[model samples]
Target: MLTHAERKRGIAWGLMSLFGITLFVGAPIIALLSWDMETAQTRLFTAYTWRILRFTLWQAALSTALSVAFAIPVALALARRPRFPGRLWIIRLMALPMGLPVLIGALGLIGIWGRQGIVNSLLLKLGLDQPVSIYGLSGILLAHVFFNLPLAARLLLAALERLPAEYWLLSASLGMKPLSVFRFIEWPAAWRVIPGVAGLIFMLCATSFTLVLVLGGGPAATTLEVAIYQSLRFDFDPPRAIALAFLQIAVTALILIVIASFPAPDDTGSTAGRITRRFDGRTFSALFWDALVILLATTFLILPLASIVTAGFKASLWGLVTSTAFLHAARTSFAIALAAGLLTILTSLAIVAAREAIADMKRPGRAARGFSVLLSGTSYLVLLVPPVVLGTGWFLMLRPLGDVTRFAPALVAVINTLMALPFVMRVLTPAIETHRKRAGRLSASLGISGLSRLWRIDLPVLAKPLLTAFSFAMALSLGDLGAVALFGSNELTTLPWLVYSRLSSYRTNDADGLALILGVICLGLAILGTAGQREASRG
Candidate 1:
């Protein structure tokens, strides 16, 4: 029942929001999709592109399988096992890799497994002549596993926890064998989450820029994103870069479709109320096994971070702090992050509102449904797009318009938000949906409207998710090197690009130091934002 003026205003706001975002993210979309199409047409039958595509899929598949395979048992143990001392902290620590930048994590891995790393150093002490190569596929696989195992574990653990206690009680009363219990109960619950997590990890690995670029070591190991960068920046092949971008989009879209097949855990309408139990002899073995598994995992994960810290401290500690480049990068990163965070929140709110309106349509005809579908699909297109390709498109388009660097930070922020939208929507949708369902009629009856409703009703209910989305967007923007690296000038470099530049020149110490500092800052902000959201939710 929106009046003519109101609807016109609403449409104006939405378009303005979209246009502002497009000024930042639109060119990237054109670049990625256009490149993909061009590649399909020109190199459609080329063996090299096909070979590259094959390797990309093959590695991602294997990596996803390996990560999920290892995570299954670990997740089950955490779910079934009693909460012992330090158990909760252990779980929190596992999520550390998610917050760590890819470059930082890669650096850590080198410290632990590099030719002259700890293991090789030990071997040297024993008079060994050979050293292991932590480069190429081996390095890529290890990094993917390190990053993904925790995600798979978290997803599976949540699923396992959702089973009603009565199922366990029945199994025990009937004296079910351990294997039988796992087959019937644990497997079914955990299997539900397997596809989602696996698909997600595969997509992540496939699109990975920093890790693959750093550790790939050669052409045989390059991913599509990395390939696009090489073609555009290093090789100066616009047509090839365009083609790679297109292929990358198609591949990403396929993966996204596969991921979409899995039912969202939030929509499943099941909650795991607490069910406590005593630890018995049989459960003790599982507990011990889990503890050992996580312990080894933790050690492997922590070593790299430790190396970064140690190395950073030993090399150029005081010099980095006083460096003009470092200070400028830090300031630029913070500014873009703040602007992107605010812009993302606004865009997300608009999209959410649009979706709600579409859903509320009494007669959601073909056109309405089609519009809804387009919006839903558009939300994910950013993820499938390569940053460098997009940057190239903008660079080409804006070259005639004069210097693009003047607005590069703002532009990059918008792209960063677009890249972050799917995740932000994922987090916010659940909280908002739950709140609206529970409080919709109450708010309407009270005649709440506009900003007042948002402040009074919506804000209280959606506070946690709002804070979560903001922090996530900010953190992601902080870590983004792909788009920023392409668009950045001396005055506009962000933290991730700065870290990469240092690492490229073999300035490992300075890179590690900056990485550690940035990681801490990001983590602290995320935690503070989450805590603030929680407090607001309670209030």
Candidate 2:
């Protein structure tokens, strides 16, 4: 039933996909295995390492619980409340934190609650003798909530949106009170997503290096990632670093196993059940609660961004623009991001094509089947191997590559593409499935295959998702600081690295300017990539 050309295309695609997936999953293990730890003391089973393991797990669990708990009611309110004039924009703006660099987001948090920050400024204005110290657990937890609340809201909102219109209509017909409607309709739908979203956020928080490193203030707030970096880069303790890296991996694997055991909530049904938009105008109590939630969420989201913009302008704009380091860093960041974006898109396409081919086979033989299984299993490796650990491996391996600094661009590109593959795969998987469902028969009947089928049928159907995936990958690549940190030299600095360096040196004003610029650049690229594909598909 298949031709030679189709088989060749599939093979090529599969090979490329294998490479992309392998780079992510294999790189980390390779790094871990290569780690040269010179010590019985440095072994992974050390008591000190075990103590950190316990603390990391504890924080991640608590943070995940708090993030999900806060997100539930907020997500419900947004879904059920009347769509005011700016609701769509409000929702879109809420997603900004996801796009923002972690360091920048942390900085924004600092600007609000730091010792000399706006909240403290206000407290002083109110005649308080001292500002609240926001440097330990309070800072870490608050920052985690700020970054994750919108994301959790988005995940839960999506679930709420999927409720069938029939559910809403029935609720209305029954004259269900708001609480009753929530109990009967929204909660059931949203509760399912809680575990997955919470787990994901927890994982992110746990793996977080820059956030904890910066906001953590000292030893009291140190996370496993920070500890690893401190051991490797600062303390120069390879045995401790390796042991810590393993500890992080073990903890992550355990958590992931727990998360995987819980089924992911359904994401499809309806964008919103056909409920009539009702404003709670008649009930003062309902109105007060609604306004309070909105106000609190909005303030938490907006004030930090506002502070960044405000600080950026207040800083010597002329000096910031004129700084050679700033310009060089920006150029380096853009160049690497572009290279990474292109590589990621190509690799992701190959992966998609390969997956489609195997899945298309009438009956894959054991050899073909084995390859498919290997490819499918690759994504999990990414979750297992943290970026810092991989970066450490590459740093060790590339010692002989000559001018590791010059190779920084290529190394960064590789790491960025790797970091972005999971997100790209997520975006493309559904789109690919939809395209196959819609065009599988038509293409097969028409005898179309390979590039011809892709160009004529799949491309049109996949344009939007492809663009979304590309944009997401690009944005992620631009914001990454992990691999770049290990690879960066005098000439190979990136905007994120520059931001980090500035923050490390306490050049807060310069960091703010660079952050604003970086955020805008990433946002613009994402918008352009996504919008361009959407328009093309429409045309």
Candidate 3:
């Protein structure tokens, strides 16, 4: 057990950390709530508000349905054809969409699907007069599917891969038909993942800010997030912004409630990667079907990414790379990203320390478990409140103090820190707990506690995990477009905002060049983050 003094101190720090995060997040919410209730009700009842709400729900539902539905077949194809050419490369490619900045992804899609894009170029050559439009709800769905489908497919593929060797062997021995094998063996694993995957995709699509903002065309295509941005940045409508923010929170909470009501699938035993080789789907028709699904999914995912690369190379970026404005934005993005990552590490450390202390106290399981849930939930609390909402709240809160743009960098850093908190905690907490478990008792017996122990013991030992957390957090913050959208100004801008400006000004080539640079940096950081984790595990 930790010493009484250390335990008490930890508990205090933990409570304080939780309270601080709560306050940071709650301040904006309080700003939203403290408005004139009568005015709030009036704003709440508007036709425009209801229209945006309906569109928001409709697009998110459609995106989630399309992504998850298409993922099943793609995943099944990959699982059944493990030895196919470029299989590993195809799996690796799926992660690209997740790492690429939202603005960059949108730009990439526009290059392929826009009115004057490659698709239209080909169609014109074929004597077609009509051009495809990458605007409105059609464009929004295209972007969402481009980003989410691969994610769902990867998740489902993992589930399929986890089935034990024995199950497949039994199926083969029984001479089960292909449909029977899928129904009894594969379907269960896929089904287990579907609900949780669907919920996550739903939440992601619902809160999507940059994608919809870029492709939303106008009011008719806007999601709640985009609507909030328009209210604060475009219309200067604080009351409407606040109303939309609460609407967003309510929608998110309701989704969570519905998701919680569905019991999660229980964990199945692991195969440890020694899967029983399957001897199925060898018929001509089966081969054709698998090939078709895999081919289509790969093409759908690759076209945009390839467009980003090829089109980016064709653009002349010497002027962009040498510009003062570009340099300033890059510097600001990196500085704010670094600050946010550092802050995330500190906050995660305090929270993890509290949890370890509570575990040492050996309280009743239910009580301890409840406290753990509360602490964990504190990290994720930011997710429910989209970054745009956070920006709007901060904007309202700071309006009385003169120019909000003057405080843009600080506010963006703070919001980015919160946005990165949940993810950083996921990475840092387990590593901290593991290290503490291995070293806590030994250090305690040696009378090592407090700052000395942290610097000498924890810091030295947990360096890899800490680096991983910092780099990953930085990667996320660096590419964030949502929080920056409402806060971006001439004095304070980020790479994402800069690219968005280019896109807005009809400077597609400059945007593509900037996107390539930004995407490479973000992807490199993501790779480093995961590489650090692997190295940490090895150590």
Best by lDDT: 3
For all the candidates, what are their Cα RMSDs to the real structure?
3.3, 2.9, 2.4
Q: Global lDDT of each model?
A: 0.75, 0.76, 0.86
lDDT of 1 at 356: 61
The C-alpha stretches of model 3 lying farther than 4 A from their native spots are 263-270, 364-371, 445-448, 455-457, 533-539
Question: Pick by TM-score: which candidate is best?
Answer: 3
Model 1: CA > 4 A from native: 1-12, 15-44, 126-130, 265-287, 316-318, 360-366, 400-404, 460-464, 488-491, 533-539
Error of 3 at 405 (Å): 1.6
Per-residue alpha-carbon lDDT of candidate 1 for residues 1-539, written as tens digits (9 for 90 to 100): 33333334444555565555555557655644554465446854677778778878887988899899988877776776656686677677678888777777888888888886897788888898646667888888988988998888887887877777778777888888778888898898877778777888888888888888888889989887787777756776766766666688789878878888886543242365755452222666766887787677667667887887776677675787678988899889988888888877887777666656666656778876775566666667677665655676776556557877986876787777787888887887777777877877686677766678768888877877788889888888887788786666676788888888888888877887888777777887789768975665799
Q: Which ten residues in a row are the worst by lDDT in model 1?
A: 1-10
| Candidate 3 clash pair list | none
Off by over 4 Å in 2: 19-28, 34-42, 168-179, 266-282, 400-406, 436-464, 533-539
lDDT, residue 354, model 3: 80
- Tens-place lDDT per residue, model 2, 1-539, is 24656666877877977875676556656755666655624577776676667667776777778888888777776776646677777787788888887877887888888888989999999999655766777788888888888988888988887766777667767788887877777778877788788888888888877777777778767888878887867776767877787777787788788878776755443463355454323477776776678778888899988877777777776787678998898788878777877787787677666666777788878887788777666655656777777766666566557766766688778777877877777788777877778777777788897778778887877877877887777788788887687666678888888888988888888888888777777878778767866676799
lDDT of 3 by residue, 1-539 (tens): 47888877777878888888888889988988887656767898899999999999999999999999999999899988979779989988998898788888998899889887889889989999746789999999999999999888888888887887777788888998889988988898898879988888888988889999999999889999999888878888778888888999999988877777655533333457675587878889999999999999999989999888988888877788889988999999999999999988888887887887788875547866687678888888877787888788888889899989888898888888888888788778877888888988898889998788889998887887788889888988999898889878898889999999988999888999999888888988888877866775799
List the lowest-lDDT window of 10 residues for candidate 3: 262-271
lDDT of 2: 0.76
TM-score of model 1 relative to the true fold?
Answer: 0.89
Model 3 residue 333 distance off true place after TM-score fit, in angstroms: 0.7
